[model samples]
Target: MKAPTNRRRAIAKALTALLPLAPYADMEKIRAEAGRAHLHNLPPTIAVWLAIIAHIRHAHTDYEKLLADGYDRDSARFFVIEQTNIVLTRWRATRFLDADDESE
Candidate 1:
């Protein structure tokens, strides 16, 4: 059979990267289970990753609205701080990946 598409592969790559390596963090396992959602066919991990991104996008919009509305200073600060850390983490993770480490 042919391999999955570039978009799907990129998704599996990214979600695998985002998730921690803790004992219970079995991304592959999650992928397998998610596959069961449809018999004989299932969405790729990348699809799930896309859904996750969508969820985060919604969260970000809500956060932005809160900040725009002059919500509590502490709450706004905390949201922005976390968002900043996430952005930086993703940037570093994808930015400086060694050529040898590019294999997935």
Candidate 2:
């Protein structure tokens, strides 16, 4: 419980630092969800970047649908990589993946 609280604080601090710099209108929701995700399984070590990636995966790509279709995690992510990167670029993310980039 205490560890989860620390993780949430870490995510909130990251969101506070990053949200003002980004142009997202729904950043508050993203930040909130990211914190929840961190508690579930999303790594808190790189919370901000993972939060952005989660946003793109859910919002801009068919990643969840692909997973539901029985595609493995890496495969689903692979299928959506380009679309994910496009949204990453739109968000001014510094780390856009090339098609040839190793996903795992």
Candidate 3:
């Protein structure tokens, strides 16, 4: 079997850290939502990384910074913020459902 790439390793580490905060987080759901939001061609790992960075940096993260740092400006903006928004919205809805279930 081929070894995991560095990007995959980074994503795994990020997911490990995020799993504690969102134990019910569903990567498949996030990926699906990102695809629906027109991020279909974006790599799943890149999308996940963007989402993780968005969560970590919150409002402090800027798409322009990504562009300044040499990322494709439009793609970076869409994946980092727009696509992450779709995933986060789904995550929030899932959390609400879990809360509702617990309240019952």
Candidate 4:
């Protein structure tokens, strides 16, 4: 197969694996809507990762603001750093493991 095809396939597989079941609090209508949402506007895994990275980067300033408002800096800092690591690991795994597939 061509490089771009392989990359798309790899990224699709990763996205499928990461896709979570929509939460339903016993509401059939809501559940159905969620399913439709998943089908209609699903974004690429790379887009999701980029969003997460952007959120993490934005949180730094938000965290500082909260700290100035007298919130605990350590807790906020730890939470931000911890989530950052999680996203980074996924990004690395997707980039490295799928390198040959051109999915990175």
> Model 4, range 1-104, lDDT digits (tens) per residue?
22245444544454444433312231223222323323234444554444333344344235566567676855555445545555446434332122123221
Candidate 2 local lDDT, 32-65, one digit each (tens): 6666643456565356666666777877799999
True-structure RMSD for candidate 4? 11.9
Model 3: per-residue Cα lDDT over 18-73, one tens digit each: 43334344543333333333433456454554454444233334665677778774
Query: Which ranges of candidate 3 are over 4 A from the true structure?
Result: 1-22, 25-36, 59-104
lDDT of 2: 0.67
lDDT of each candidate versus the true structure: 0.43, 0.67, 0.43, 0.40
Q: Which stretches in model 2 have alpha-carbon errors above 4 Å?
A: 1-23, 37-45, 98-104
Report the lDDT tens digits of candidate 1 across residue range 1-104: 33346544654565556544412334554444333333114345545443333333334435567767988744654445455446435434222212233221
User: TM-score of predicted model 2?
Assistant: 0.61
Per-prediction backbone clash count: 0, 0, 0, 0
Evaluate model 4: give its lDDT. 0.40
Candidate that scores best on TM-score: 2
Per-residue lDDT value at 73 in model 4 = 54
Task: Write down the TM-score for model 1.
Answer: 0.28
What is residue 14's positional error in candidate 1, in angstroms?
1.7
Ranking by TM-score: 2, 1, 3, 4
